[model samples]
Target: MLRFLFDTIFMVKVAYNDAPQPWQLGFQDGGSPSFEGIVELHDQIMFYLVIILLGVGWMLGSTIRKFSVHHNQIVHKYHNHGTLIELIWTITPALVLIAIAFPSFKLLYLLDEVIDPVITVKAIGNQWFWTYEYSDYVNDTGETIEFDSYMIPETELEPGQLRLLEVDNRIILPVDTHIRFIVTARDVIHSFAVPSLGLKLDALPGRLNQTSVIINREGVFYGMCSELCGILHGFMPIVIESVSLESYLLWLSSQNSPPYSPLQKPHQFPKLGNPWGGIGTPSRGKRFYSTSSSSIDFATSSNEEPLPPLHPWFVTGLSDGESSFIISINQRGNGWTVRCSYELWLHTSDLSLLHRLQSFFQVGSVNLRKSRPMASFTVAAIDDLFSVIVPHFTNYPLQTQKRSDFLLWAKVVELVHSGSHRTESGLLEIVSLASAINRGVSDKLQTAFPNFTPYKRSLIEPCLSGLSPNWICGFTDGEGCFDIKITARGSGSYHQVECRFRLTQHIRDKVLLELFISFFGCGKVYIRSNNKAGDYTINNIPDATNILVPFFDKNPLHSSKLLDYLDFKQVVELVKSKQHLNPEGLSLIRTLKASMNNGRRAKD
Candidate 1:
């Protein structure tokens, strides 16, 4: 019976040997003193424990000795006399504790210190898995590649691989290299910990925490997720292999392809219920609402016919006392053309207005028409459906030029598109106008009237009437006005000008100024010039007017009103006459011409 039992035990050992060893548990050469620092600290703690034990043992021995010597002979007890002894004992222990605490504090601070590392790796924790990225190390072409690490299952693991501990891919590192690690999570909280290296950090979703490590020895080490994140958390383990730089590089390249085959069957992940309210249903349908209060009844009776199609819309409550709207465009006809419109109710005309529309079926165009607070648009569809939206005032306009009104409007468009279901392809268009301005100005006029400045006021006040005379040339004194000023410079052949005037607010004021250089197109006005004579130069000069207009009918400058004021036309003639002169001379003439023309146009 004993022989049979021995044979059974031997068989069991052989069966266990057939199982794979954990990758992390395998022997490796990292370097000298691989765990010396931790070992030293542990030894120091053990030494202190031993010293305490010895001290306690000695005290007990002394008490026993004293008791044996005195036995029954002691007759008087004086508690007050022992005060000095009590003080000595108390102070000595306190001193020992302080001595221990000083080093402990130092060690803690050292652990917290995140030194400037030679390399940084980001570790993202997910349900029962971990993903790592070498964010700082990019290839010569600036491309970065990252991979996920998953544990190998017990049944398919190779020989010598430990069950529940072997991973498909090992974290490869160079021995003696300091590495900074950033930890984060994708869904729930997780922790990254390696006991041998004395490193542990929490990975919180949406937040990043950091720790550092330097492996002194080249070896494969094992670690497991320190935090209980899910049912499979215990199955997830970390395997790190530290090697020389050359070996590490080789291993890294080898990891381009995973060693083990992926699981044949799809992982049966637990269905996640509604985390916000703890609802157990995994595939709940989307809840729809018809009103902002979220109280509108959407339930349908069994006998009632299907309700009418719900027109989709989004309302964002803004910090300002107004809201905006977004409308989606749907493709209805056989061709790409599709039209959609919406009527907004307003209590007062004081509210601002904005619109955003998009299409999805096919690439198409958008057209917008506005009459006061009402707006209509037609979107040519490429795909199946399109969408549009309007939003309310969230912030004051142009309170600070630093605020990006256009970017904010873009976000509103995105919100509208994402809120709707569209099948067609189309373009998105956004138009915004303040309620106070009945007519919108052109891009050029807008550029000129930045911040609704004095120039804007000069033009807007007089041009509201369509029949305003040429104010720059003083052709109509109070009837019309124009204001022009140099706003910016560039390194090209032209300069930028801010132009504003009152034209009919309802009429399209945009005009293309074609430069008639002897009936030829000169390049648009640019601020920078190649003139050798260092004369007046402009950058980004438009294809329109070549002359500058500084003032309008209300305020005529004497230089502009004078016949011999060296206007742009006269300067051009003069430069032509001085063809033999240097480019600088020509440039000077051009500058004088631009200034005179600007002033003259304003007065005209």
Candidate 2:
């Protein structure tokens, strides 16, 4: 019996995964918060297993011993089920099932709830290797941070490194912060499993699957590809090195194998072709690229909004659309300097608006590059940023998706404000915060900061208050839509080109669609696709031509959508002119519509 018990204990030890510990029992202690719950549920189930075994074992033994044929003088009548016994047998098992169910459901729920992650790390599993990225963290030059983590060869492993688990580059993470892994595959299917962290997600080709983890303790946790991923299946091992936020930041800063010289700049991206199709770069490198303060064109157009100054809220709203807050590593003399700057870009036509903001903010400079058609309002001066720009937003905050970034930017500013950038440690902290802002850290920052850590992401909650014109512009910059569709009759003849303005949302966010009705003073919310989607739509030609056209034309879209809007506006004008009446007119409208959203196919 003692030997049996000892063997059972050994079995339990074999099951623990934490690190395949000596004399281990059951599962390895979970490396993350949710994993602990998983371990607890496993233990709870085992406890029930032991109880069922012992209770049944004792009952059988006792019945056999007490009711022996040798001791029985008379046998009981043919067996009939006792009501009490039946009740105990049926309800007792049900109770036991209930006991097992509650925590099991809770553990499953805990695993499914993906909390807002501060840093989003993308992992792509390949046939024989893995590539990890920190792309969201971009630089002032429109650069991003990305690198591949290949498994270390056995012969190259360090003395203390686990032979097969060691990697040329380790996955570094922060302790006590949420991390979301966007896992995908380049070719065959693979699973990125980290047993210690209780994370096992299949990496499917062209499909992005997400799983979040928060490590409670800092240590090196090893994982492997559980799926059969060809000849190198064993070679691809995962080594996650978790550390405190500060240590992780310091480590990240050390990654620039060959540090970036400030002279190297990323190329400029093209303008948005179709806003409805895809968002190109955020309205001209506001996140990463930097424009010189001297190049800003302060020349306001004759028709520009004159100063009593644009209201701070209006400025905040427009900035959410037209502006970018950039954290940049710049060249000053022979040395590199890290600074935070704000820019508001406009076509030469909106120079007066830029000038208006410049006067209102009273900090930034305005300029136009000699040959460029665009004018800029820029505030690169550190003192003015903290004194004027920061305080204004603090009073009347930005109410768009960009608000989260603004908060993170403020953190960077505070760090810069306190002269933290001058110190080695402070610079590292700034690098960590910098990687998490905007669309996410880019590959450039990763190369610059070896130990770059991504802090908790800013929570991007929409404005809860009433909407204003400028606020609507900023919100639309991120989510609004304008569309034109041309359909054929059942008989295959061309019908009138239908023009509509729309904003779509998941059924859960119907209120935002309702809010649009109040903002536009026109349009109605229509439930599309079996109540799965809600669209705020205006299909009326006059309303779109008269109301929507003038508003956007005056205010103007600052994104790739501007291209689509211009195309859409042309189609609306042609349709209003009865251009669809004749073949030549119809052909012109068709030609213009072809270049519009989702291209020719979607329009038809």
Candidate 3:
């Protein structure tokens, strides 16, 4: 009996109370104080309306009944001269309007006034979906949590989920907390409106509209795009899961977790329930969605289930920046055993990504360094190097100067596979080729083979006339930089601020760096004479604001660099608004600049 009563109570507590009901005449239950106030103002106006309606109806009826020709048998002469009735009718409405206007204005201003909120969520409307970002929180790697919410198709909807309203990801917020939503649209105009909370705001492109709300209770509320943006606009839905403060924090933590590392003991993660509702059970092989349509697949298993593979283009782009192809000569007895290996290193936080790469190529092992916060994926077996690593890169092709090094390394791999390392001449040739790759042949090998000539490396001729957006995005995540520079102009008190988008590579990749000029239709390539390094930089304000900003806004970086990009973009906006001329705005820009890149790492 107790269990039955508890179940009944739970059912009643959640029974579609937060959603629309069939043939309902009134609004859904208000879950916010603002909505409650709106309701009160509505009722106040309705009360005055009822009184005016009754009074007018009674007066009309009395006038018709008393002045009828059949009853009075006479027509009133000089009735138009009566000023008392006219005065009463006009004055009564004026007094009623005055009473209504006060509360109406009060509620209007209350809705417009914005309080300082503890949490700020950025909601960006796209064609048919919503993108949300929590700007206040940063994970261990200095990355903010962001995700896209898409409506679940009717075919995929579960038992209790609402059609056209159920979304794959719901925006979670803490109940009773003052939260600010900064809304804007990416492509076209859309509206972010939740009827239950009385939240309705237009998400205009290129303009940010902000509103504050304090959820009064915990439950799931649904909303849709109220604007007629496009045909699919009806498909976009908004889901808000207001939960307790503790549950919200748990969800936040789960979103920004670093990829698992082998060096550390497995950390226990709190399970929140369904993947769409909470951080899904990792053991159940749930897939996490990125801001894009492509999902970042993650699964846990004890029976050796195959992990998801990464895109080949992404692999090539990352390898062009982070992977090293090396030929190392180690002493075995009195002779040398030259071995070839391909390696990529990442911060320990990205160990899971490396694991995915391993699963992608069907080779390599992930290992951790004992001395640093780093992990590596290495392919050292001769067969694996020749069959998997070599073939993958050959098919995808590296675009940077790394391609030159890869070519050299591939030669050494072939030599080792052919057992040429067993002969003196072949070993000398292998070492010479290795000498041209990363960290060149070790000092001992160079000292031993002092007379061997270094391999002649041919310049890599890129096949394509342009850069791929995905490849560029991935490569930027590794070698690209979004920087802000502030320096004094002349000897005056004024300062000059500049936003820089740069890609630097070794001189061998100067041709590749030059390609960026045509690729972006801006930016100049400068080669450092002393260091043989090439820098592709865009310093023109117009170019940075127009070309570079929009490009990156469309194809975003995926690493911690994203934080820097966001800051850079913010600085660009400040500069655009001429805010940097003021002391406060300059100081804010300086703070942002200082908190980026190395400053961000220092804070970490």
Identify the leading candidate in terms of TM-score.
Answer: 3
The collision pairs in model 3 are: none
Candidate 2, backbone clash total = 46
Greater-lDDT candidate between 1 and 2: 2
Kindly report which residue stretches of model 3 are placed more than 4 angstroms away from their true locations once superposed.
1-309, 349-352, 423-428, 439-453, 463-466, 490-493, 529-531
Clashes of each: 89, 46, 0
lDDT of 2 by residue, 562-584 (tens): 66778888888888988777788
Model 3 accuracy (lDDT, Cα): 0.77
Best by lDDT: 3
| Evaluation by TM-score, superior candidate among 1 and 3 | 3
lDDT (Cα, tens digit) per residue for candidate 1, span 267-369: 2222322212223333211111000111111122122343332112111111111222223223321222112222222211111111121121111122111
Question: Which tens-of-lDDT digit does each residue in 249-340 have in candidate 3?
Answer: 54654563322332222233333332113222332111111111112211232224554456678788878888888777887435787767
lDDT of 2 at 281: 31
Q: lDDT per prediction?
A: 0.41, 0.69, 0.77
What TM-scores do the predictions have? 0.36, 0.40, 0.47
